[model samples]
Target: MTDSNIPVTEDELHAYVDNELPGERLAAVEAWLATHPDDSARVASWRAMSDTLQAKYGAVADEPVPPRLSLDALARPPRRWMMGAIAATLVAFVAGGSVGWIAHGANTKQSMFANFTDDALDAHKLYVVEVRHPVEVAGNERAHLQQWLSKRCGYQVRAPELDANGLKLVGGRLLPGPSGPASFLMYENASGERFTIYASRATTEATQMRYAANDGNGAMFWADRGVGYVVSGPTDRTRLQHVARLVYDQTEKTGL
Candidate 1:
């Protein structure tokens, strides 16, 4: 059905798919769906595509830990003590020559996680505009989404409620993390502006926050407890941080 023919606006359809609509607005959409079966079918098809996406990538978190990640192997000493000393000396020399190298490894890890955040934002930018198929799992199926993602990520997944920030639980997706799988939960404002919070495990340090601007998208990344989180959008820095704080609070409350 065309936009004009449908009772909901394209933006509303987008919100519906994102689970941004609620209360009267959500009820309105339900009422509209009751009268417009074709539109309902279209929405269903779109949701199916989201489901397929989740099926394909969601399990990345659940994959067996790679052999390279074996702690015993990593902790094993070098075969030759002299050779190990020499290697350590060489590393120290390299670290001394380039302070950036010391920071580089940590920076590189952050960059890798940042790239995942970019992917999450890209997915949000792409599918949020879509009238159909905005999410693989609907908001109503949130419990199932949580169970599935938590199981996959090997951590409990809790959907953060953001009503205080004028955002609500839209739904979440499981994405790949640095070591394994990660999670991305999206929220939006009434004006259709959207923001997303992405979290994964960090190898370097405790959660800290950094701001970055990439191709007009502003992102803020932080690590707390064990998970690293990145919040990104086209919105202003202050607004982005506001949203990030909400995410942080919810995540903290969830103990994730």
Candidate 2:
């Protein structure tokens, strides 16, 4: 493994999984992955998934082109939504479960929530211990921070009011999301306990709140008006949900 100054981005991780990383960057990513066990594990999962998919679909790709599936078929390519159905078909075929998923689309809540919660918790762990510079813009600049994040994310963003829950805004920062850019807002209470709320673009309109926890950290995730939100902290589920509910309520009032 070699080391370099340039840090690898999420796109590079995907490229590494697909064997699409440029020659100049491939070794650097490998070196980064060598030292980053968590990222390496994620890369391994994606590689396994890709291998499984290829093993299942390689024969389909090799099959002689059928008359109905000729080059002309590309003229009337399926709509955007159908792409998900197609992916579901491939997953169902490779995974050997839920044959009906091909028709139902690829909106598995469990997997989606896992991704959201994992990202949120990872961010929380990375910044919560910082004594200074935890956020790019301090809570004193709430309006500016919100505006900057909303502009970068291509959506209206706001720092939800959490004072009633005994949490004051600690400020926020930008992050790479599964879809695009995301916003992470940190808040602290009088006890010095801190929590973070992470929001990103989502495919669906609504979702029931879901809870997840590990190593004394807990999070609640949900979706509303095309944004998925996850609130995470080093607290129990009951206390976390209490704060999550407050976040959800305030976010809803913004109407997006």
64-144 per-residue lDDT for model 1 (tens digits): 544322334234443243354446557867778567456555555555456545655554444444334445566678799
TM-score, prediction 1: 0.58
Per-candidate local distance difference test:
0.63, 0.76
Q: Tell me, by TM-score, which candidate is best.
A: 2
Q: Write the per-residue lDDT of candidate 2 for residues 167-235, one digit (tens) a residue.
A: 999899987765667798999876556789999887678999999886467899999988999999865
What is the RMSD, in Å, between candidate 2 and the native fold over all Cα?
A: 16.1
Model 2 C-alpha lDDT versus the unseen true structure: 0.76
Which regions in candidate 2 have their CA more than 4 angstroms from the true location? 1-86, 89-99, 102-107
RMSD of each: 11.6, 16.1
Model 2: weakest 10-residue lDDT segment is 65-74
